[model samples]
Target: MNKSNFLIVALVVILGAVLSSVFIVDEREKVLVLRFGAVKSVKDEPGLAFKLPWPDTVVRYDDRILSLDVEPLEVTPLDDRRLVVDAFARYRISDVEQFREATGAGGEQAIAVASRRLDSILRSQTREVLGSVSSNDILSSDRAALMLRIRNGAIQNARAVGLEVIDVRLKRTDLPTDNLGATFERMRAEREREATDERARGNEAAQRVRAQADRTVVELTSEARREAEVVRGEADAERNAIFAESYGRDVEFFEFYRSLNAYRSALQAGNSSMVLSPDSDFFNYLKSSGGISAQ
Candidate 1:
């Protein structure tokens, strides 16, 4: 090779070596320098880092918050009710050396292993903390407190695996499929009983109102009948007194007036016929100008 060509190849080789030895650690990552498969140093802060070009490597781990969703599992609470629970966890790698030692793998593989470990820890802790509480408590507004306890427990247990459990949350808590039907039936029966009670109360109120109205009607009718009878009795007494006074004033005139009224009543009848002598008292008014001929 020519002199200039040889210098150009050597420069390229030197550039490759320099580039291979240099690595970058960003704000989102924690880098580990492993020499011969053993972690030699850890770079937690964001900056430029270096490692030997040959037989040395750099492994980057995401230092930011990570999320892992646990599959739905069944748990029995203190109330002895079976519930289906789904949980998720937020975590971050806290100790890089410990993390590397635990997984013995780098990059995505290590993250996957750590995630599996974290999921297991969270599931166990979830069961432990949730099982101590009643199902209603787990589903109540106080669930936030229960979640905090589970997170704390998970953090404690995960420390051995180099994970920092930031938070643990229950995504959903539901009754098991086998129990849902029975629960719905119980709810329906309870509602039906309440409805029945309301209807019975309404019917009772209606009956009371009807009975009171009937009683009021009977009382008003009875009172009206009594007043009518009193008025009728007073009218009869007044009529009898007037008749006696008229008789005392003129006995002959009263008899004549009564005889005229009787004759008029007998003659006014439709197609009426009477058999009587011409000189009979019944015809006195018709036979003479003055009834009874003033006898």
Candidate 2:
């Protein structure tokens, strides 16, 4: 052989030896080695490894967290409403053998297959299982529990297909396109109705309170009027009695006292200017009636 040909052969042998002896796995990955179309061994750790290159195939997969996003699906709610749900899942490969055997003996292809299965699982679960439960329960208390149950259920199904589901979670569940606007309108109407009812009740209570206060005021005013009437009647009766007693004591003096009192009260009440003859009847009381007076 020529020198150049000899060098080429040596290079080919060296390259083959290097290829046959070398295997590498990342820290976040695991691998399965297949020799002659049969799985020879599984590598769960990281770093360099040695294997026969010609007949052995190294299958690498992520050992760390893996995530899968599910496309949105249309769902019919218990209330007969349509909703679109989109979700995701985080998982890790639990068994290397099952993963290799079921998912085409490798991580990349195996995850793809597992994703399809997980999708089916999610769809079926949301429809048949989650649908039967109350919407309030799902929205309120059991959301986490529901997710966990779905995760466990997915894990169980994944195991059959050589996949291990670490977790499953819901990202969003929303009203479908046509129903979104209607749902918002209905929710707004319901809240507005509630607000209106609350306001009406508050107004009713305020009216009742005002009416009660008005009634109390009226009652107190009537009571005060009644008391005032009683006092006035008693005062009038006492004044009349006093006049009667004075009149009974001396008839002429009583008449003189009454006439003088009337004159004093009438004259002092307003501006008065009076001109009268002393001998007139208006001044008769002060006149001397020693002989006889006219009737």
Best candidate (score: lDDT): 1
Question: Measured by TM-score, how close is model 1 to the native structure?
Answer: 0.61
* Model 2: per-residue Cα lDDT over 113-221, one tens digit each: 7678767876776666467665555555448887887787777777776666777777777777777789788779878999999999999999999999999999999
Residues 1-295, candidate 1, lDDT per residue (tens digit)? Answer: 9999999999999999999988889999999888888888888888888888998988888888999999898888886778899999889999988877777767888789988898788888888998998888987866889999999888888998788999888899998898999867866887899999999999999999999999999999999999999999999999989989999998878888788688678787574687878778776667777556554
List the RMSD of every prediction in angstroms: 9.0, 8.2
Model 2: residue 242 alpha-carbon error in angstroms:
5.8
Candidate 1: misplaced stretches above 4 Å?
A: 183-295
The C-alpha local distance difference test score for the whole of candidate 2 amounts to: 0.76
State every prediction's TM-score relative to the real structure. 0.61, 0.56
Best by TM-score: 1
